[model samples]
Target: MNKTICALAAATLATGAAASEPIAVTAPGPQGDLAGTLIEPAEGKPVVLIVPGSGPTDRDGNNPMGVNASSYRLLAEALSQRGIGSLRIDKRGMFESRAAIPDPNDVTISAYAEDVSAWISVVRARTEVDCVFVLGHSEGGLVALEAGQKSDDLCGILLVASVGRPLGDTLREQLQSNPANAVVLDEAFAAIAKLEAGEGVDTQDMHRGLMPLFNPAVQGFLIDMFARIPAELAAGVEVPMLIVAGGKDIQTPVTDAEALAEGQPAAKLIVIDDMNHVLKPVEGDSRLANIATYSDASLPVHPELVDAIASFLEDSKS
Candidate 1:
């Protein structure tokens, strides 16, 4: 794993009669060092690795690109409150993990899967647990599936608002679903096509508003990601699996979770009502409200989402 323990301890959080320390943790990455937070209830207790989604999302599940919802952070807190341990990590080259790599855009899905494996080993070593559960949200679920193929130590996998089909298909659906993206729909689809075909899309003519998403720097990585099918990976998983989707999620719909469960018929699927992509509760069927939750960091994630994850982890351990 090449993990170096420079652990800094923090006060323990009460979770029922038990409590766990929130410790700063790190592991070696291909380019540098990966950083994360580890909350351990006790040695040998089942732990979860909270893998963040796409873009510049950090270990806390908040990104500067208008996504400040602390999805991962809240999930970790909720799990800890139930006496479950968890590790939420920053991808190499972002936020506290910025120094882990020279450039984030130079990475691929396989690299991320490898990082997951490293994290699994590091977490097990540090917590003295035999295995760890992986809870991957959105794009991170794909990484979890790939990492599962590489390691037998994983206790199970939880896919939250993750895709079951190829990324190109989901990208198209998401772009077309939003009227505000209508102006850039054609350009976005064209770029996605090029990336899916393993080619680079020139961004010189791309709309300035879409540059952050389709910039040349990230094209190579996007091309690699677009090639991996999450369903195919899920189908090959031999470990316990759970797929959670939000009924009101605008980004990745409940159907995606259905497809994942279909791919792996043994997997348990749970669809939470009013839960959005950011894990926050959204009212009615308002897309505006759903999207607004992305920026509201203070909003608590749907309680059902946490309950589902904690229950799944407990069952996995048994």
Candidate 2:
């Protein structure tokens, strides 16, 4: 946690474009249908697909886990200002995407990749751009990487806070580093190991003592979750990429972004000095309030965060 990174994420926010008229669209999803808004540049410009992160997260980069800054919305607005079009959407069975699936947790990275394709189809039909770039945060970054591998129409990939190392490895490191609970540390490790092996540990079983680690829904994702590193996946991609990490991001450290960038032949890396996971500027190494700002809509995300992505996107076009 970088004490000086109080403005890391705040630098990436777009404060002006939220009031603009954003184009809205709803596309068919695996479980049901997803609702989305496409914010295009007034002058007509290339578009980006705003991929949502994990666990009931909305198109706005918000989640039921407490993030509500509408980070993705701010990002889209910022991109619009840069003359780049963007499409943000609700995940399957959440908010407007509620109809996309029968059960929200029944989704995995592959499903998300499918959703990206669906959104791309919609973007192509309406916009003149030949392909849309993918901007994925955290878990969403993995989805974007997967999609980029297959989507020939993909313009490029922009990964923010994406898991560069295998998720299982990151989980182990987090557990070892966190001072929270010593009791569940080994249990959590065992469960993660099982999930990594593509085995299911009953979240209900006590002797196994790995419930939260192996929830039925998330387990399926974990089967493939910790399997690949985002950098390795993006390494083979021909699309241009920009990888940004915050100096103080406790969830996914700046090193994670560096590792991903390393795997690629020519990807740019911009490490903000003091940005947190939520793009907020933190005053100290204490991550105590990091989760708190996720709900702070009035707070401005770090400008550098947005600049890094926008700069990379613009540079790629050049």
Candidate 3:
């Protein structure tokens, strides 16, 4: 909901000389094959699985629904430069994994966690690695934590711009932040309340601008997502966890990161001063300029974002 719906410019793929061929990897899903791209640098290097955020995001972190940051592509190249390999994936029913399911909306957080577990096995077997680190961005962070709880092969988690509160509260905050949304605020809240209560909202009376978020097709998934409390989930995470927050991020604020830290206490929290939700550095505070980066794939990811991950991974290697 942070991004406007529009056509996105295609994100340019990054090339790395040290990186191996774009190894196509797949896992058995209930529907079909869950697809991913594994960029193995060499043996012994830790493989970081890049779990993308919500919507129709592809393996490269761009979504045809107006998001073309290429953040995950740049992240993979940066990790490769740091002697770490990466496995970026297209979620089941999304992008290249579209064949995995007939209806992309027919999925839940648990299913994504299962997909992550499957990807981990694929990475370990293909790269001959002992364990893999998962770097989840936004909603993907919740999936990583859920997957980490179910698997012991995880090295740790690097959560970026992710939620740390119940999704209902987060959604309410997101709706209230925009002055333009004032017109439909009451309707949005009512719909969210119903969804949070495990009941489906009848979007027949919904505002045109809010219909997409409360539509019948995605209500089941959204209801499942709303019930998930990120802080509660993070509290049970037994592996090393790093909570990253972008100071300029308009979606999930730094307070959410603080909540995760408070819940886990053991998690390392890093707040990058100028980095936004897209993992890019923005100079101004204007919402328009901040959101402009979503479709601008040319901008490089902030160097500090890479530095943070590199430092964390290096330090955690004991």
| Per-residue lDDT of candidate 3, residues 130-242 (tens digit) | 76999899999989888877657788988999999988899899989889999899889989999999999887767889988888999999999988888888888888888
Mark the 10 consecutive residues where model 2 has the least summed lDDT: 1-10
Which 10-residue span in candidate 3 carries the lowest summed lDDT?
1-10
Q: Candidate 3 versus the native: TM-score? A: 0.92
Q: By TM-score, highest first, what's the ranking? A: 3, 1, 2
TM-score of each prediction: 0.91, 0.88, 0.92
Task: Give the best candidate by TM-score.
Answer: 3
The sequence of per-residue lDDT tens digits that candidate 2 reaches over residues 198-303 is 7887666444434555667667777877777777798877888888888888889887888898888588788888887767666677656676667887777788
Q: Is candidate 1 or candidate 2 better by lDDT?
A: 1
Q: Give lDDT tens digits, candidate 1, residues 74-114.
A: 88877776667899999988887778788877888888888
Q: Which runs of model 2 end up more than 4 angstroms from their true locations? A: 1-19, 207-210
lDDT, candidate 1, at 166: 87
